[model samples]
Target: MSFVIAVDGPAASGKGTVASGLARELGLPHLDSGLLYRAVGRALQVAGGDPDDAAAATETARRLDPHDLEDPALRTREAGEAASRVAVHAGVRAALLDFQHAFAAQEPGAVIDGRDIGTVIAPDAPAKLFVTASPEVRAHRRWLQLKDQGVSLDEILADIALRDERDSARSTAPLVQAKDAVLLDTSEMTIEQAADAARRIVEAARARWETSLKGEASQKG
Candidate 1:
């Protein structure tokens, strides 16, 4: 029985860093699911497709080569914005769903982080965490990150707000907390503290999964 930890959160919520730390602590593979959407956006841009064209976005997603997604250029603000636009398309989300699920099923277990991982992609995951922070805090975090990259702080804050609205209002798999997921508010927490708390949750879930698996095996035996 493979153990899966699904971490869901909005942008700049620190979920990604927490997920990576938990995965490292547990020796599990970590999948940043947002990368899938960004890959499609980057692909479309490179192919000269308009970001606002849903049909073009869907086609790009359908034909996406995960290998090509490894380009460091995909991590830029422009690509992230483009990805948010494409992510609202149902076809684009559907195209990337299977790849995320496959990664979650890998051996020893896996840690997956994204907007919908806990709710839509890995609902049955043994451990589910919904990490978040106040919108102001999230925006501030994004502002600083972009500022460090030489971007204007005011523009970055406005973009963060817009992206948050778009992500939460999308019809398909909108970002929301899963009912059974543990909610971690990192509004004032350090990365190490968030990671430690998440590790404790995962450890508890792993124990439960092991116990359940043992019971099933005993019944079969």
Candidate 2:
């Protein structure tokens, strides 16, 4: 079986950065799962479809091309909101499940980062991280990323709070930490510090995983 590292968290929580670092450190491919949803949402928006319409969102997700993931529009604030909205539908999630699963099944291993990766997408992953930070800290990071847009820090904080509620309260595949996952709070940490901490956590998990595999092999022998 391939090694899968599941990194999950809410918006702007540094999960994406940490996941990328892990992939590079482990020599694995990294998949930003949120981009899938963002692409679906952007496509639906382009088609004049409402995100609240489950059928429309599901259809948009079904037709989503892997190429769409590279569209720069998907990185905008509007795209993020739309993604969160469409993500509430179970149908939309089902439509994108295969794409995510295929990425995680690649040879060698893979790193997947998203809200539900640990809880729903890759529950059996040997290494799982629930990365998070205070809303203010997350908002600050997001503001720095989009500061040129002239958006106020307060507005950014409000949006983060709204997304948090929507993501956590959604009925399907809500943002949550799996019981076996380690939590990394980056509220007061720099990017380098967080990356180093994440490396340590994954290294520990990998050791345990190797040991378990060896134990199983001995029992079989």
Candidate 3:
């Protein structure tokens, strides 16, 4: 039985950082599934394709090179906005689903983070977390990150709001907490605290998994 940890959250909610930290702690592979959408968006932009064209985006997503997806340029606000726009396309989401699932299947276990990881991408994952924070807090965090990169604070805040609206309003895979997912509100938690809380959740899930396996073995015997 493969173990998977699905971390879902909105932009700047700290899911990515927490997921990465948990994966490192557990010696597991980590997948930032948002990068898959960003990669498709970037590829579409490079091809001069229409961001609203679902078919074009899906085709681009199907052939995306994971290597090209890691370019630092994808981290820019423009790329993020474009990615959010393209993410509304159902076809594009479908195209990348299998790739995300395949990554989660890697042995020992794997951690995947994105808006829909717990709900859409890895619904069966034993450990599912929905990390979130107030919009103001999230905006402030994004503002600080962009400020370090020389982007204006006002522009960063505006971009954050716009991205939040788009992500929450998208028709396909709109950002929402999965019914069975454990919610972690990070509004008052430091990164270290949030990561530690997430680690505890995963540890509890791991314990359950082991006990279940032991029961199965006893039944077989």
lDDT of each: 0.87, 0.94, 0.87
Top candidate when judged by TM-score against the true structure: 2
Clashing pairs in model 1, backbone N/Cα/C closer than 3 A? none
Model 2, range 1-221, lDDT digits (tens) per residue?
78899999999999999999988888999999999999989998998999989999999999989999999999888899999999999999999999999998888789999999998888999999999999999999999988887888999999999999999999999998999999999999999999999999999998999999999999999
lDDT of 1 at 33: 88
Q: Least lDDT summed over 10 consecutive residues: which range in candidate 2?
A: 143-152
Winning candidate number (lDDT): 2
Per-residue lDDT tens digits for candidate 3, residues 1-221, read 68999999989999999999998998898998888888888888888987789899989998988797679888877678779988999999998988887897888779999998888888889899999998788888887766777787677767778888888898888998999889999999999999999999888988988898899999999
User: Candidate 3: TM-score?
Assistant: 0.93
lDDT, candidate 1, at 218: 100
- Candidate with the larger lDDT of 1 and 2: 2
